[model samples]
Structure formats: structure tokens, C-alpha cells
Target: MTVEIRVSRSPGERRVALLRDGVLAGYRVERPARPDGVGDTLRGRVVSRLPALAGGFVALPGGESGFLPESECEGRRLPPEGTILTLRVTRAAQSGKGLRISARVKQRPSGPLALLERGPDQALRWAAAHPAAPLVVDDPAELARLRAALGPRATGGAAFDDALESEADSLALPETPLPGGGRLIISPLPALTAVDVDSGGADPREANRQALPELTRQIVLRDLAGPILLDLAGLSLKARGALEPAIRSALVGDGLVQALGFGPLGLFEMKRARIHPPLHEVLADRPLARGLALLRLAAREAAAAPHRVLALSAPAPVLDAIRALPGALEEFAARAGRPLVLRDASLEEVSDA
Candidate 1:
């Protein structure tokens, strides 16, 4: 199978499209440099606890508030609201929340189980299936060991084949030639992805209002081939048209496609292929925790015009690159009439603040 990968840049973000047999198999959008999220270990103070919810709120060191669900509140002592608690970001932002885990002790399985650690997805071990397996409370490691020692003998019933068939059968895209399209946003969850689409100008005045974004999103999903998520938050109901096709697409193969009317804000909603962050977006903006104040500057001269001066400002790397361009300095001098000015700072310093 030949795979052709193409990377293209747009005004605000970069796009990556993978084509197999002339079909668009995968697409990724990288935003203009940002920060990484999740995976950070933090020590937070319990702001409050809810016995009913079996959870508490934590004031993270940097002033971020997190929820520690009761399922994870295993310690004997229920730390008072102000008690300092340690935790880590397990899953990315989901349903307006971040998944977390406490640093307290946990559990695991103990040997040969260790050797079969990779096949849990294939196991049929339900609570009732393996009631005798010792819950060797310790850490994540021990949990894996115990599971393997006595986990179902990898007896992948029809369920396993069904899941594999679903994954393999869906996500099949088309070879339609699309214009320069770009998708840029934060990395979605690893298992499911939601996609939202906005048309350039689908106006009803011209009679081209083909369901506005709802239709646009559907077109994108079919064109892109893969999972589709439409997160329309402010669209009108009548404009949604019928959602049967989109819904049908979504339900296929474990819902590779999901469509809905406007969201809370009236926008379309759907799901798409669950891929990791696109290469470019991952390289530039991984942990999106803060902002960047880096600066770049450039001076340019015009050949001849009413206004023959130009001055540019941006970040340090951009400034350095601009200055290195041939005739860049002279052009800047002539165009700006006044020398271009620049202030440089480390990318980290600019964003960390």
C-alpha cells in the first residue's frame, strides 16, 4: 500500500493530508505554535470535598482548578478542602473537565501475567468472570501483573472480531479532489475525535445556503473519509435539515461518524477519526498552558509607490529569519524610512508568563 503524505501551510495553521490510492485517508491541522497539555504532575490543595460525589476540587499550584472524582478518592483520610493533594493529568480536556489521578498507592497483578500484558483489549475478564483474581493493591504495574496471571485466556470471542472489523471497515475516505482545506484546533481525545466545520460564506441570500455548516460538515466528513465530529454550537434548528445521513455515518463501526443539530450554542456536532496531534501542531504547540510574547521585526523598502515604507514586528526567531533574507535590511531601511525595531525573548519566557 503506497501512502503519500503532503504538508501544506495556510494563513493561521498548517495542514497534513495522507492519501492512499488517491483517497484522503487522514488529515491533521497544526495551529500556529502553542503549549502542551495533560501529562503534567501537579501538587494541588483541596479547595473543597463532596462526600456525595465522592470527590473534591483542587487548587493546582498555578491556580488551575481540578476535580478528583470519588472513584479515585481511595485514601482513608478525606483531606479537608484546604489539604494539599498531589495528582496528574490522565486524559485531555473532556466535557469541560480534565481527567486526573491521585499519587496515592494503587494495585496490580503479580507474573506469567506480566508476560501477557499487551492483550487486555482481547480479554473477557468482567468482574463476574474473574472474582477470585486477587486485587493486589499497589500500583499500575501490579494491576497489569495480576490481570495477566489470571486474565481470560485471550479467548477473543466475536466481540474482538467485531471491533477489529469495525475499525478496518470504516475510516475509508474518497479520492475526490478537494481544494486547499485546513483543519486547526487542539488535539482531541485519543479514542474519539469531534470535528466541526465552518463554510467560507454559505449565505441564503444567494440561494446557496445548503444547510450552512451542518451540510458543510457532512461534506467534509464524506470527503475526508474517517471519523467525523460536528461541534456546531450556535446554529438554528430548521437550518439543520434532516440528520439521518450524518447519524447513520456516525453509528457505523463504533460511531466513526456522529452528527447532531446545533450544540448548546446552536452549532453542528459530530465525531471524526481519533488520530494523535498532527506532526506540525505537535512540534509547535504541545502543552497549551500559557501565551507567548516573543517578538520579531523586519524593515522593507518599496520599489515605488505613494507609500514606499514598511515595518514588521513578530517573534525573535521570525525576526532573525527576516533579517537573514537577502536585501532584507536595505529594503526595510528604504521602505520604513525609519529603521525597524525589534525586542527578542526566549519562547519559553514569552509563553510561561
Candidate 2:
């Protein structure tokens, strides 16, 4: 299968879409202000150990702390309180949980709490993982940075296709239409994500069968990890058991996913490794996301009417969030080659004049 990676850049976020045979297969979003520290190596001081929890907290740089599990210590003893240890971030902080770190004592170095090594950004990591796939980016600066980092491997131009962007944007929606008039309603909760399979008058078994592939695709594209409960449309206990193979087959390539069969409540249970914040969580801050979206709109308007002075009007909170982003408005104005007028108004009121 032909695979390609496309990157889209805005002032507030960078979105990466992985396409297989011209179909959107995977999607990832990265924000400039909040990075998911999944592979960072840091020198941290052990805070305390709890035998009951089988883990201890380690104070990281920048006043953040991560939990170091005993299992991740390579069967070695946990470091004592206040002892400095080399640690690698295994998972990002998400859902009210701190980061998950593991001891990398073999590369131990004496130093104050600080970042020892920065992890490769998501796009570069994706490129390294899929060497055969061509990495195409939209922004020239991003392309140059990738070229500097990957050298000859970064052989692609600014080609973030509009159709691909549209497809990726649709992934942000909670409802996904499936074949044969069926649809999947995905909702992410604090405990576990729930996927309701609505047959939409289609045959139950067929709808359930057709929903598997798209369901898995949505799961991966949304980066939905941890516990997932699927309520199949009108599937019996025996029928669900019979369809186990199909469910497992749908989630084949992703090593992090595990199919745990059907639960007592008739919900199919699955678990995925939590590495980074899910897409919903990444965009959870509604005001911030809306503010960035407004900026994107302002950029388009500015491009369309270069001579007109663009004025953005929105709620105070949204405007405040936009202003809080360092150089966001300035970058937009610089790219637009004009200053933008900001106006505060009601939440429902938004306009670019």
C-alpha cells in the first residue's frame, strides 16, 4: 500500500495526517505551548515511594512531576527520596494523571533537575518509523527544519493537499457515518470512551461487521487510548463471541491495542496504551481552540483581501486567549502584511471585517 505523510501548520497548532493509498489513516496534532513529553530524558529528584501504589513521584524540571513505577525501574531498587536519577518519559500527562517516567540509571549523570535530552517531534518520529512513506509538509520553515534534522530522508515539498486537510478535520467530529446507513457515535469520558453503533435501520450483524474497520480507524485517528467500550448494534452474546475474530482482525497492526472480548454489560472491551493526550483532550480547551480557529479564519480573510484592514470581533475571553499566545497575532499580521483590529463582543458575535 502506498503511504504518505502530510503536515499542516498554523500559528497555534501543527497537524499531521498519515494517508494510506490516499485515505486518511492516522492523524496527530501538536501544539507549540503544550508539548506531550513522551520521550524526554530528564534528571529528576525522587520525591517519595509508596509500596501500596508500587510507584513513586519524581520532581521534574519546570515544577512538573511524574510518577515512576517500580516495574519501570528495570527490576532495580527504587531510588531514595532526594536522590537524583536519570529518567525517561514513557507517557505524557493526561486525564488528571501526571507523566509516567522510567529510570534510565545506566546513563546516570550527576546534575540538578533539568532536561537532559529533548525527544524528536511527532512528525520526525513518524518519518523515522515509516521510512518508506514520503513526508510532505505545507510550511517551508517546517520543511527546512525537517530537512536539517533528517537530511536526505526529508525529500518532499510543500504539498498539504486541501482534500486531505478536509478529511483530517472531519475526524474531530464525534459522529462518523459508516457504510449502509450505519453510524458510530464516539464519546470520550473521564473514565472510558464509549462508542455507540447505530445501525440506522441496516441489518444488525452487517452493520456491526462493517463498523469494525471504521471504528478502529477512528480510534487510531483520534488517538483514543486506554479503556474503550463498544456497544454493538443488536448483537447477542453468542454472536459477539463469534465476531471476536473480526474485531481482533480489525485492530491488527496497532501493537498497543488489546481486544478483551465482551463485558458483562454487552459492551466490547478494548484497551490501548496511553502515550499522549487524545485528540479530544488536546482540543478540550474550547475557548483556546475557538480562538485559534478564529485566527485561522482571519488569516484566510487577510489573504483574500490584502488591501482591506482586517478586524476580528469576538468575546472577551476568546480575544484574551488569542492575545495570550505569544506573537500569534503579530505573526498573523506580519504574514498578512497588515495590522488586525481586535474588538470585544458577545460570545455569539464573531466577525472578520
- In terms of lDDT, the poorest run of 10 residues in model 1 is 288-297
Cα-based lDDT for every prediction: 0.38, 0.84
- Give the alpha carbon lDDT tens digit for every residue of 18-70 in model 1: 44454444444333232123445555667778787677776664445667776
Tens-digit per-residue lDDT, 1-353, candidate 2: 89887876666677887888988887888876667888888999989998888889999999999999888886656778998888999999987788999995466768899998888778888888888877887666677888897776565554556787577678778999999999999999998999999999999999999999999989999999899999999878988788888888998878889989888888889999999899999888877788888887787788778899888888888889888877777778777888788888764353433
Worst 10 residues of 2 by lDDT: 344-353
Model 1's TM-score against the true structure: 0.33
- Give lDDT: candidate 1, residue 221: 32
TM-score, every prediction: 0.33, 0.93
